[model samples]
Target: MEDNYLTMDLLRFTTAGSVDDGKSTLIGRLLYDSKSIFEDQMEAIEKASKQKGEENVNLALLTDGLRAEREQGITIDVAYRYFATPKRKFIIADTPGHIEYTRNMVTGASTANLAIILVDARNGIVEQTRRHSFIASLLGIDHIVYCVNKMDLVNYSQQTFSSIKEELKTFSSKLRTKDISFIPISALKGDNVVNRGKNMEWYEGSTLLHTLENIHIASDRNLIDCRFPVQYVIRPQNDKFHDYRGYAGRIEGGVFKKGDQVMVLPSGFSSKIKSIDTFNGEIEEAYSPMSVALTLEDDIDISRGDMIVRKNNSPSPEQNIDVMLCWLSTTPLQPGGKYAIKHTSKDARCMIKNILYKVDINTLHRIEEDKKIEANDIARVSLRITQPLFIDSYSSNKATGSIIIIDEATNNTVGAGMII
Candidate 1:
């Protein structure tokens, strides 16, 4: 029998909230109620809960894997957990909620299809909630869920959930995000997390798990603009059938198939697709997010960082690009600062030419007077690169429109930017 896991769809989502908002507990509850937790893991959590003198098992311990995290009672780093259900496989990124960890939330939300913003019913909405929601929208997440957690603390009041939901709707309107939903739950009590408990009788909606499995994410990918960034040039020196050369990389956008005429960037070389090679065999067609090695009918001087696209539909090349940058380092971003820019597989040097404005994440206002960008600051800036980059607007195609900045001296990623 064929394994069902092979065909199951995968979903990547992140959980963001303030400290002690039950982000970890909600993830733990999902794992526990869905029967994804192992016997040994459950035993350890049970023992730990008893050691801490808790009446109920501390489900947060399941995601707080680090010893320091458990000791401090906070999430200091991004913790990723994997679990599978009958319908879908899920990868959960439990991001830290503190203001200092804003960069971590950006990193976690970068690749997520949906974001769950947990709000404490007792506290209503706070600054951290707005901060995370803004960052999630800025990262281009399509779906957002306002999970009103700890409902038991507020007596499972419908008024509390309704009020919080309305506040969230009003706040999110200023951002680019559109799809938002509300769910009331008590993560500690496992109410309406994975299973619908009897506590909330007024709330009518699918459980969190059901919503996750049913959300239509297949349309999230860009299937119109063909973009293939060649990462490697493959050659076989062996004499078995020695004349084999292939360009290997992931398809970032659109569809690519054998015999399709494609053009290479910068070089303006044109070639027809010969075959799509895989470990198993040659594939007939490939689309966005598929990794394959393509052999061209005509061999041209193609190397890493060269992009392939349809001749009629190509990305614009620019040497001076405007971008919205999220500073990730402790050092403030200075104008004229030089850094290493990595866009797709292309790497080059760039200098910050101008700082247009800094965004006050709380208010979504552009602060033009204070152009200095500090750690976890988001700003719109202009950059001049040594070479031209083939790119698109982030709204058009995320895979081809994003860039990361690396500190030249420290060799660390200091910023992430999206082309405007």
Candidate 2:
């Protein structure tokens, strides 16, 4: 089983590819090969396989659970599956591959640490490949695993793999990608996915499982910028601790320690960290992703949505900001529409100030003529918020650097923006 139950470790991974590139199959194979599936689940797939008259069991059947999905043999929604090996526990987001479902890919990849871009060996690279990589980079995902799937169909040729690798290198160079690695594997024949394949003797790298288990993801967060937006206030009215007041929140950035000075955002009032409180008792320091109730030396009327950050390295407070937005609504984005702007935990009413230009993601050219940006389209736009937002560049900090737009009428997320 995954060490999560034992150690509370979790890895969130998302799969991306063109339709029929075998993203679902790859996830099923990983789960099956890792012995993460239960016997009852295996039996059900085996029975389903016999009914379908397939030569071999469709491993993808394990995850394609919807009746409409199984009938059509297509992944429509973002199917989240959880499985674990002794070394690690994984939450896999099997994202839809259709171009129309670009929003689904964005939703799945929002919290992912690594993205597995599956590419068919026969097709090589395509526009969807570029789009997927662009979205990964935009979302601040550091690691990219280019799994060249269906290697058995290519006769396990190194030439084909090398050609794809070179093309990926050339294409990825134009993108703002940080870490990229290529691996050849046949998800169908199970080569180099969980075990080394004898057919591909020239390749020398650990299997995909090894890569997932050992990737250096510990230092991915920006440790220099300390951002703690209080989510809730804990006050227990008991006899023992009647006067206890704590600020409950998740650490969004850098290390926080006792006696370190922190400034509440927009207020500019400085205070010292009295102590860091956790269920396990008091701690001296904390970092990003850790949930703790912080006790400050002074009670400065702090509440939810209020940010506690380092006084020296604070973000610029501004109302007007430039952003790269990926439209997610069917209604085309109007240049001057009012919407609910959510930055970190703080909410504000914002009006679209200007529409700069929409970029053709397939070709990376700005389409000046196309002013109307529809669903799945990326564009550069400016916003004028009613309240000032404290943020850093999206390229530097994902937490403080990103915002999601929700429509006032329907209350749906209409777009995602990256602060520039």
Candidate 3:
């Protein structure tokens, strides 16, 4: 049972929508119906609900743990929750919906495999819906489930659901995400959330829980381009292991096997994988997201920030690159400003060579006239790095294609960028 639990695949997903679209409530419903909540948690929620003068338990309380959020009845910061069913484990990032909290949503959804965008049935497709959907696409979330929430308010009307679904389809057609789905649900009334309630008999879609448990995410990882960025160097000089030299890191893409021909970047040294050692023991093979120490056949000087890739298939070395940058700082982005850049395991300095254009996320248009980038603003910009980086396009490999810019004086992460 322990082994089964350890081996079970985990899914990371984020919930996004406008204010009061029921993102938190939907997550609460999942945790409750799945029996993942403890008795103490339930009792606390019940007590809090009573204090708030609610007739029924406020499911949103399960995730809205902040005092300010609870007092104001709005989620300001990202709230993360964990739960598991027999089918799979889940990490839920309940992100804020306000436009000011756009950076919070980006931070929560950065590492997610899927996104659930809640749409109020009464309003149909709104501005926030389009904003969240576009951000999800920008973050390379291939799977998107647009939950048509608050179905009970619309009397669970099939016509309303159909119309909203059509509108969503038309809007999402412009997005790069290929896999899109729609589900009608009422987080408050628990209709078609965990169980298919009788309120929507005309709807023949799977419940939200069922869809989450069975979404096809196995092929979502990049398996063709092999990339392993060395994070640390392990060398035990003890009596038994006097000559041990290993490069320890997490694989970013593709599969690596013993005896595979690999090359170290920057230095461009060639070596074969001698062994792949994990915490358990030596493994014959390792793949993306796996942390392992790799021993090379030859003695080579490799250290942190060096990438090991298939000898024939390697990321191109780039010194200047174009990126879609999301400015996360209060100070507006300054053209020709130099900042510290961190990408994968590598670190370097980068300068803002040019500010190409700012994106009007709601309209999906490029605003070339406006060069000033403020907080929560997404823009296309050119960067000139101090060192050549082994990189792939963000669309191809997320792990190796994303970068963060840190303010030199403040040492704060000011921007997040995706390689174009």
Candidate 4:
């Protein structure tokens, strides 16, 4: 909400691909052509490129900001990059392409409105492509742009591009991805990147940057089930107003208004919404994704970790939860392991009750036997929380529907879970 450029409609997207698929180059091209690159940054990359004795500038270096990444010339960690175009402000999560870093892709894609899955045009769809697509589907990413990169190597042949696109359509159809688009691009040579390419006149779609800025992402929030997790209680006894009690937090789902009957979860205390307050003054209404505080007509003991919702639209409060977890720590996720489960503004201890299955990403097969889930591995597991959790399926709402497992001692996020 700061001084954003004209393109203030923020677009959060994640890029994913196999090694050498040119994901980084495509991102760098976007940032460069948009003139989001500063003179100093460009000069630094130019200097580094000359030091490496490269014939041309290594555009990928713009996103690979890690020192170890530069030395090895491979991305081993997720790098977040920000850039803006005249039509939109964008955040790109440049995740690693290696199969070992599947967890990184999930972490990056979890909050993404769209995902760009790149493929080498010459290679077609490979195992890694299938894996990335599957994970994207599992994480509920709505949009996918398949960039068939390295088109220069393929002679920019429309036949080659169409053939690869056909194969991709056939393979990706088996996944649960809701929407997908295809583009032929040479991230290194800049064909069909930021502008239309004369060589590929047969392709009629807009450039990657245009598509990103114009995508229909306005209808992504859940405005049906009202959820407000209390983050703080504001009680100020000022001279003008002796008694002021307000429960403040961000709305995770649905809408709220004055006179709407609300229920306090975990306690099941029913109350009528008296007024919704904001810094500007009392607002008549509020909805999902907005931060506001509410004052009930009759205070019935609402506190932090308590959720306010429409009585009939409230999510289930349960202790036993089934989740799909991606292991993130070096320590393996063992059965019966205990960790702190944090969901929304609530936190409690939970134990891994059972290992349901480990998904073979490429095959979409559930392996019931192999349960040795280590770092970067994803498995469906059951957990028992010390207290009740207010959750909806991850497919419905992303905020109240997901949780993270934190190590009690180190406080490291060891795993992320999507409630099933």
Candidate 5:
């Protein structure tokens, strides 16, 4: 049972929607209906719900952990929850809905494989819905499941759900994501979320949990271009293992096998994989998101920030790159300011070469005249790095194509960028 649990694949998903769109309630329903909540947790939420003068148990209290969030009945920060079913494991990032907290949504959704966007059946499509959808596409999330929630309030009308679905279809046609789906649900009444509620016999589709368990995510990884950035060099000097030299890191792309011909970046030295080592022993092969130490046949000069790739399929070394940057700091981005840059395992200094344009996320238009980038602003900018980086386009491989900017004085991450 333990082995089966460990081997079960995980799916990380984020929930986004307008205020009161039932993002938290939907996740809480999943946890409660799946029997993931403990007795003590259920008791606590039940007590709190009574104190708040609710008629019934408030399931949203399961995720709204902060005191401010509970007091205000709003999610102020990103609340993460974990649960599992027999088929798969799950991580849920319940992000804030306010436009001011858009950066929180980006932080939570950066590594997600899918996004669950809620839409209130009564209100239909709105601004926040479009904003979150655009950001999900920008982050390259492949699958989007829009839950048309609160069907009970709308009398579970098929026409209401159909109208919202049509509007979403028309708006999402402009999005880059291809695999989009819709499900009518009543999170408060426990309908069409975990079980196929009888109230929705008119609708024919899998439940949200069923969709999450069976979605095809294995093909989403970049398997053609091999990218392995060296995070650390392991050298254990002892009598039993005196000659142990291994380059350790997480594989960013493609599959690496024993005896595969690999090239070290920057130095351009060539070698073959001697072994792939893990705590469980040597593995025959490794792929993206797997952490392992690799022993090479040749004793090349390799260190952190160096990347190992297939000789025939290597990322180009770049010094000047264009990126879509999301500014996260309070201080506005300076035109020619210099900042520390961290990309994959490589660290370097970069300067803002130019600001091409800012994006009005709601309208999805390029604002060429508004060049000043403030907090929560997304813009296209050019950066000149001190060292050449091995990079692929963000659309091609997210692992090798994202960067973070740190403020030199405070040592805080101020911005995130996606390579164009």
Candidate 6:
């Protein structure tokens, strides 16, 4: 039992689709059927359902937490929920489905291991479906599950499911997804959600809960290139360990072991890893996403935003970058606009060199003539930074390849870009 507990991994996934596609309901059903919700929460939902004159308890209300969202019956911001099964722990990012909130969807999916693009069976394929699918592909989501929701509304017709599946396949051929699966589900009726519903007699695939528990996500992490961005310098003031000096940060890629030779970026200083220290004790090795302090064999000047990486396989440091920019601010992104660029632990000023093209999400067309980018618009742009940043392509490593643009005066994150 202890070994099984130790080995159970966590899966992070995001849901995206058009408005009223049952994205929230699917998540609520999963939580309710898995017994992850509290008794008081269930009673509260029942009370809300009564107030709304609902004959049955509304599961969708479970994730629509904000009063505005519950009153409006729409998800305006991203809702996150956590639960655990015997096989795996899960994190769900329930994103808004409206076209206007495309930037919210991108923020939720940035760290997801997989994406679930929901579609209403009655609606078949719509424009929003294409838009969300394109965003998923652009974000480098390798695994996609097209859940044809509201199967009950369509009378659980296999013919309808088949037709929608075919249409999605034809549309998604233009994407760069590696794997896509189709599952017909009725989020309201609990069909193929946590348990298989009797209405779908022809479907032979595993339930959604089972797939979430069993999907392989171990290969999602980049474990070949070592990149550790130092976030803090640890120096215990006065103690028996007075000479102790360590660099603390979360490892973004590859495996780092004790005694391994490493180099500090910007300074080009080399040293050997003396120890990997964690809260409990010293660890033999550490990998991506693990937060630990590392002591070096030699005393070196390393500060925040400085990266420690393997000498042979190091990230390229460059000042000019080509990126796919997702504009999130109301202010239009124009050529020569200046903003603060935040990449990992580094902060630098950058000027927009050029706007290559704005993409039409529905058709995936590059509108080269549109040099101005407004809210929720995605475009390819070039940027010139004041300092060289050690980076990689977003496809090569998401942790080191992404950046956020902040308005200098207001200090608001106005844009997110994936380095190309």
> Which stretches of candidate 2 lie above 4 Å from their native place?
1-8, 67-76
- Cα-based lDDT for every prediction: 0.90, 0.87, 0.92, 0.87, 0.91, 0.90
Q: Which residue pairs overlap in candidate 2's backbone? A: none
Q: Rate residue 304 of model 6 by lDDT.
A: 97
| Candidate 2, 169-287: lDDT as tens digits | 99998777678999999988789888887989999987898898888787887898999988899999899878788999999999999899999887888899998999999999999
Q: What does candidate 5's lDDT look like per residue over 303-378, in tens digits?
A: 9999999999999999999999999888899889999999999999999999999999888999999899988899
Candidate 6 lDDT: 0.90
- Return the TM-score for each candidate structure: 0.96, 0.95, 0.97, 0.94, 0.96, 0.95
Model 6 worst lDDT run, 10 consecutive residues: 67-76
The reply for model 3, stretches above 4 Å from the true place, is 1-3, 69-76
Which digits, one per residue and each the tens of the lDDT, describe model 4 over residues 115-200? 99999988998888888898888888888999999988988889999998999898888877768899998888788888876878
Report the Cα lDDT for candidate 3. 0.92
Worst 10-residue stretch by lDDT in candidate 3? Answer: 67-76
True-structure Cα RMSD, model 5:
2.0
Judge candidate 2 against the unseen true structure and give its global Cα lDDT, from 0 to 1: 0.87
Find the 10 residues in a row with the least total lDDT in model 1: 67-76
Write candidate 3's Cα lDDT for 254-371 as tens digits: 9999999999998999999999997799999999889999999999999999999999999999999999999988889989999999999999999999999999989999999988
Model 1 scores a TM of 0.96
The C-alpha RMSD in Å for every predicted model, in order, reads 2.0, 2.3, 2.0, 2.5, 2.0, 2.2
Give the residue spans of candidate 5 off by over 4 A: 1-3, 69-76
